[model samples]
Target: MVKKIASIFGTNMAEPKGETAADRAYRILRSAILSGRLPTDRKVTEAGLAEMLDLSRTPVRNAVGRLLIEGLLQRRKGSGLWCILPTRDEIRTIFDIRARLESYAAARAAEFATPLQRAELVASAARMALLVDEMLSDPHADVVPRIDAENALFHCKIVEAAHARRLELLLQSTIDVNLVTLTLQAYGTEQRMRSASHHHEIAVAIAGGMVELAGKAMEVHILSAASFVLTDPQADHPAPRQGKMPVRPG
Candidate 1:
């Protein structure tokens, strides 16, 4: 079935200068995925998407192929192309990779972090601890969202402190999957406190220029959080559709 593009812009609008049809399709599709408008497991067909965007299949195919290569899209036999539906092992693997990259970032943070960056790391941890404290004092304080926001700030400051833009770029998608799509909802008060304590240790190690300790602290922080997610039956994740070829056990 053909779908015409919406009249967000009046008819007879031409493609922007210096942008190809594929480029235009790609930006729109990526925005949909990133914004959760096209949630995980939602199917996409070349013809359908091409028609929806008022583009040709050749360009739509090109755009989808690129997203597929980036791990944002996956293909199943019956399901065709769909948003990512990660399995348990896939989630674990993502964390493993994050742990490694973050370890390196933390170590570098210790060695190369500026005084201002170290101060920010400490502040980030302190702020996150305050959120945990608030949640504990009033269970219905409506602070989980605050904690999630601080969680991103806490880790991001560490990575950004290292002055490694390339590393940050590499970890952006994994971080988004955790911070944006998934969350720390699986953690209880005790777990939140433990994770908070680790952040403090990380901040201190970085402040004191303890390279190995800083790195280990970061590793522990991530793995500990990942443990909660893996064990939580209700953890937010993209579930694999049944009847597809099963992913091998890890």
Candidate 2:
């Protein structure tokens, strides 16, 4: 089981000190969901996750309840749980909201980023680009998950630089709910490479201090990803009830 999950998620939790068991369980399962390591339709039991995490079922149960409330997981028929996979419309609509927030964030980042912040964002972008190249050069390499992690890091930096707490909170849930995460993994190599290039372009635009260009680049980056999800047959969950973004979903 360890080797199987490692093969899928590429890593495991280290049982960090100072956190409660439920906290640890939540983080582990959330990461697995974002990276698609836990398939959406696969029903999992509390006993299973507790065993997997080397914890009593109590912590796993508590964590599962939290995820259920957050709409990241769903209660199955009878008694079960499954990670929620978003629909095509939900994914696309989330990106639409993301575009509005992040494009403005890029402009603010350009306007506000200190030299050190700018440098760090550029470095992060470079790492994402390198991962894309690595993935493209080797078709079988399990680099998708790594790129997903770096992609989060790279974009989080932009929000950090922007210094907008409200914007960060709004975007964080969107990012965490697997909107951006699922979109990237859904892409083919060409599309992923294009996304990697957009990350580079966003970093360059901000570093160059071009506020408008930075915003435009960010918008284009997110919208392009939304376009991809709209075409996916698997993104076919019942069209989410009318809303620009399902901020809270089930």
Candidate 3:
């Protein structure tokens, strides 16, 4: 039996720009994975992807390699490449790392961030707030993805302002993992929007030169979000016991 293949583009195709084939392939595949088009736990083959993108095997292989290193894709011992799906324990560990790193970054950003950096952070936060408002007004809006993207940008800017490349890269990796979990757990909810607003508060505190306040706010924000995702109604629950087991008498 033949598997159904999705069309590369249902619309007109513009002329290709001067970008490298590998770069194009990377962007296309990354976009698909991030946007949920190539969903979690889905198997991806080099030949299938090459056919879909109208490219040869080499570029697709390079793109897949980069994605695998970025933790967006994984290769099994006997199976092919599959989209990375973090276990519950992995999710908890990533969130714990993010909470510590982001809080420290927020504090350092408050202390050493330049005026221009502060202004940019403030502007990003304001833009994020407006996006949140838009999402709240129309739950079915197409801006949901954009909102998530911009929210990520806002946090990224804060981390960059801290001027810690090591921390930034670590946070970025963990964030990519967290985003998959967030997308799975947080589809549409007013509470999620409110949680985003709290992120804005962290930005405001940092911009105001309140280092301790910024750190505390960021810590609370990350922990709360992690907890929400872990315990949300849509999240996986424990399975029921199969049979009665012998119990020791007290």
* Candidate 3 colliding pairs: none
What order do candidates take by lDDT, descending?
A: 2, 1, 3
Q: Highest TM-score: which candidate?
A: 2
Model 1: residue 67 alpha-carbon error in angstroms: 6.2
Preferred candidate (lDDT higher): 2 or 3: 2
* Candidate 2 residue-wise lDDT, 171-196, digit = tens: 64554354554555566788978888
By the TM-score metric, which is better: model 1 or model 2?
A: 2
Structural similarity to truth (TM-score) of each candidate: 0.65, 0.75, 0.74
Instruction: Put down candidate 1 lDDT per residue, 1-250, tens digits, no spaces.
Output: 0011111101112335688889888867764664455656456787877877778989989999988876778888977787763557877787788789889999999999999999998998899899899988999999876776666666767777788777766765444352223435345789889978998999999999899999999999888877877886744453322333221111
Q: Which ranges of candidate 2 are over 4 A from the true structure?
A: 1-19, 31-54, 76-83, 140-142, 173-176, 237-250
Query: TM-score of model 2 relative to the true fold?
Result: 0.75
Pairs that clash in candidate 2: 88-235
